[model samples]
Target: MTTQEFWNKVKSPEYKVTQPRLAFADVLVQNQDVMLSAESLYEKTKTIFPKTNLSTIYRNLESLERLNMIYKVTTDDGLNLYKLKCASNEHHHHIICTKCGKVLDIHFCPFDTFSELAGKAGFTITEHRLELYGLCEDCRK
Candidate 1:
């Protein structure tokens, strides 16, 4: 999405969309497919807004996550990584490259069969999260 488009969405009643939040969103937009940690994002945002602090970065990130503008992925090492959420309206999952931290969205959802399985087991599903991790094509080489 363009910067203007992002800012328009940020105007929602759910968020205030301050300057620091815009800077944070810009960084994520520029690095769309790469997952970044809070520290890493702070470093990047510092280049744009030198006055911004780590706490501000964390706060903006939390707000963006709450707004569904970004998503979090925990690495195998237990570190949290984040990336811009895809703008599609469809339900999907993601595959992350363990080596390079590159992310690719998988449009097909396995839970499409949830209703069938749930019927057999007589269980009610509330919500779910599914993420796949492996080496990407470039990382495999």
Candidate 2:
């Protein structure tokens, strides 16, 4: 979404839209398709707001995640990366590049047919998350 579009949503009563939060959102919106670690985000945010703190960045990220404005993906190497949620509200998973930390969204859900199996096992499945990992094209070269 454009910065204006993002601000329009942020203006809702559900979000506070503080300066730090707005700066964080700007960075994410600018790099919408890229998955960034907290440190990476903090570094970029500092460029936008020189006084920004690492803890504040983390707090903003957590708040955005809680608000469903962003999602986190843990890489195979155990690094937590985050990106803006898809503009569409569809359910999807991500395929991450372990070598370069790139992310690609996959629109299909693996559990589409598992409900019957879950019922047979006397278990009810509520939600699930799947992250596929491998080298991206550039990383493979």
Candidate 3:
């Protein structure tokens, strides 16, 4: 979506558009492959908007989340991370590292096969989140 369109979505739900919010969205929209924790995003956005604070980042994240423009991801470490939800993409899962908190994306929903198995077993599955925790290669080294 164009920046204008994205901001329009943000505006639709009584959300205020500000430089900090715009910058925060830009980071997620641009570096989409990397799911970032609040602290990581705040640290990077600060270079462009030096006055940006952690509180502001958190607020902007909440606003985006309210609009469903982004999704909240909780790492095993109990840290909250955010990823942009693009309408063009389908549902997916994430693979995150235990040692370094790195996140990797799985483009398709990982539960379809499990759904089949559960059906065979006469078990109904409504929702699920599969988080595999382990050391990433770099961390393992």
Candidate 4:
């Protein structure tokens, strides 16, 4: 998302814009292609606003996630990584490069098929997340 678009979302009455928050969002926007952990993001944000604290980064991340402005994924090793949500904002999945931390949107949704199977078991689905992790072409090479 562009800086303007990011600001537009952040303009909600509930959220107050601040320099630390802006720097945090800017870092995510500047590195949209790769998912980053809070620590990694904190390091980058500190470069822009040296006085920023780790707690601030965590708070910003949690707030943005609640606003649905960012995407979060847990790595195989259990590290939580985040990135700015794509422009579509539609229900979707991701195919990520485990080695390089690159993410690509997957437009397909398997919920329909799963729902059918789930119905046989007398269960209903509420929500789901599907992320496929592997080496991207560049990493494979």
Model 3: residues >4 Å from true position, as ranges? 1-5, 8-13, 97-104, 108-110, 120-123, 131-141
- Candidate that scores best on lDDT: 4
Estimate the Cα RMSD of every predicted model relative to the unseen true structure: 2.0, 2.1, 3.2, 1.6
Worst 10 residues of 4 by lDDT: 9-18
lDDT of 1 by residue, 1-141 (tens): 777777776677767767877787788888778888999999999899788899988887788778778878877789989887777878888898888778888988788599679968998777789989899999899
Candidate 1 achieves a global lDDT of 0.83
lDDT of each: 0.83, 0.82, 0.74, 0.87
TM-score of candidate 2 relative to the true fold: 0.84
Any runs in candidate 2 off by more than 4 Å, and if so which?
12-15, 76-78
| Clashes by residue pair, model 4 | none
lDDT of 4 by residue, 80-139 (tens): 998998888699888988887899888999789999999899999888889998899999
Error of 2 at 106 (Å): 1.2
TM-score list, all predictions = 0.85, 0.84, 0.72, 0.89
Residue pairs in steric clash, candidate 3?
Answer: none
1 versus 4: better TM-score goes to = 4
TM-score-sorted candidate list, best first: 4, 1, 2, 3
lDDT of the structure predicted as candidate 4: 0.87
Evaluate model 4: give its TM-score.
0.89
